[model samples]
Target: MTDSPNSATAAVTLVSGPAGTGSIDDFELFYARRALGRFRARLGRQGLLDLLAADIDEGNAFLRESARASDGGYTGGTTVLSTQGLGAGEFVAWMDKAFADENVLLAAQPEHYLMVGQANGSVHVVENVGPHICSFYLGDWAAEAMAWADDADELLPKADFPYKKATNLFLADGTIVGRVLIQFGETDDGFTSSLTVYLPASCPQDVLDHHLRHFAVEFRNWITAAAAARA
Candidate 1:
């Protein structure tokens, strides 16, 4: 991946959005990404999914209420990479085994989750590019969105990109507020990731600005956590 001059820090930019036509633009977004250094061993597809899925319990204060499964279990709420090569039943069995035997590096950090959900059911977001709280409900969409990323290579062939993850944002009341998409590219040392947050065109200017700062904070923390895990 090509590096941006500001990549070292938490720099966010408005890659795409609406032009204030008064009509709603569903695909407005701000984007940011960074390349964390390589590790002794890189996280495989399943490992990466495990780390992201752990966010509900491990994510910072920003994540609010997460959706629960029908069985009343914490779904962990992140999608797996494409199950392209394996059969459906085989993929299911593999996932079962993978979860049962968590990664060694990940298992070592029992207290720290890749990301954590708030116990108080409030979204704590960071403003001014620092850590704070913002309540966003992540449910089953987490899985579906990430699955889309896994299939992006085939779906958006013209884009010619691969290894991506995505998810929509919602409030506790179930109002769809925004969406996030992260693209991953391998590097000699490790990998680089680009993240984008899409909001509705009807959103206010201040809210959009705040989300830019929000992206800066959360992704920076996440990258740090990921680096630690790989180390």
Candidate 2:
């Protein structure tokens, strides 16, 4: 595991599940390593938003930075969410649908180990063997759609959107790891978004799962906070 230069308080651990062993127990073991903690952001909220709102390549620079720090492969590209904004409940429903969607997996032989589909939100966990990667993403259908759009089109129209927020976290089990949280929303000005990252190069599937769940819970709270701030 390596420590992230951006976050002195955070560390990233590299881990791999039992190789060539695919069983229900192994699946369970993989996810059992889930852990969580918060880390300081490398850049302020406005700065991160500037990066995301910048040209397409720069917009995704944060993900690449995360990939480098974690020493793990990451999903490239952006996903622009749907036009239909969602209420909190609808957001949860969208997450359930997204978790059920099979296309979210990568080229690797992914084993869908655990799935948490709740009325408030959803989390999909998978182990990607070929690249030795484990990833968990939390967001609703609208958020997913937005991510896809950003991934598909680099120079997306951002004039309609403003405000972005991101935060960093230090995740640990036996050792510390890097994790990131990112959120993008609409504002009258430019764009609003947030992001957090945890480190070494790789972390266990369960560890990632834990962070994913953390994001879901915090996201609901963020909705309330964001709304309150706007009001």
Candidate 3:
């Protein structure tokens, strides 16, 4: 367990588990099972597949690029952060809005997302993780995620898991390089979030570690921004 650099009013603890071991397909399947099970249960088998297919069609530029770049390998880590006075719902809304504004996104994690520029509907982000300027489909799966969070059935209630959002990363040329999956659960005083970053398996250990730290730093700052918005 390690603490990332944070503001005086924010407490963000990051615990990085072992790097994922497997081919890129294995990595994708692992996360799909963990993150999409509830959606499957709610959407039914065929419905879930349809939703996924639609999402892929809408924003698969990165997927196309990743296939060309990753060479059948991938690595990633999850960082868990617990903080006070911010609910999962509030943070999710703020995050969605922040992505639309390059300034807000960069402000939240300047150390990691050094620069953010608009390219078509996606954002081209320059980060400390690598030398390339990455392109990300910020709203990828966002609508579906919000819908899932809002629709709570008797079998799977919202009280159990409050919010979730998944988006992807790509190179400027459209090759997929990484992904981000965030799940947030409400706590007594605030919330706990699991921030996961997936990179091509060939990424160095230091780069993977830096990404975990990057998640910690950016999210801590975003929590502060969300709190200020509420005020």
RMSD of each: 16.7, 18.6, 17.2
Q: Summarize candidate 2's per-residue lDDT along 25-52 as a digit string, tens digits.
A: 5465445422100111343334433543
Locate the minimum summed-lDDT window of 10 residues in model 2.
Answer: 167-176
Better of 1 and 2 by TM-score: 1
Off by over 4 Å in 3: 1-70, 112-120, 130-159
How does each model score on TM-score? 0.37, 0.26, 0.58
Worst 10 residues of 1 by lDDT: 29-38
Best by TM-score: 3
lDDT of 3 at 185: 84
- The lDDT-based order of candidates, best leading, equals 3, 1, 2
Q: Write the per-residue lDDT of candidate 3 for residues 1-231, one digit (tens) a residue.
A: 333334355554434555855655456656765554445357653463354454434334434544557784566588889988888888888877776665566565543333344555555554455323333434353525434224322112347555766666665455666666677888898888887777777555666787788788788878988899889
- Residue-wise C-alpha lDDT for candidate 1, range 8-104, written one tens digit per residue: 6555555647565432222221111112112212655345445455343333223332222112111111121221222333322332333333232
Residue 53, candidate 1: C-alpha displacement in angstroms: 27
Against the hidden true structure, what lDDT does model 1 obtain?
A: 0.37
Better of 1 and 3 by lDDT: 3
Q: Report lDDT per candidate.
A: 0.37, 0.35, 0.60
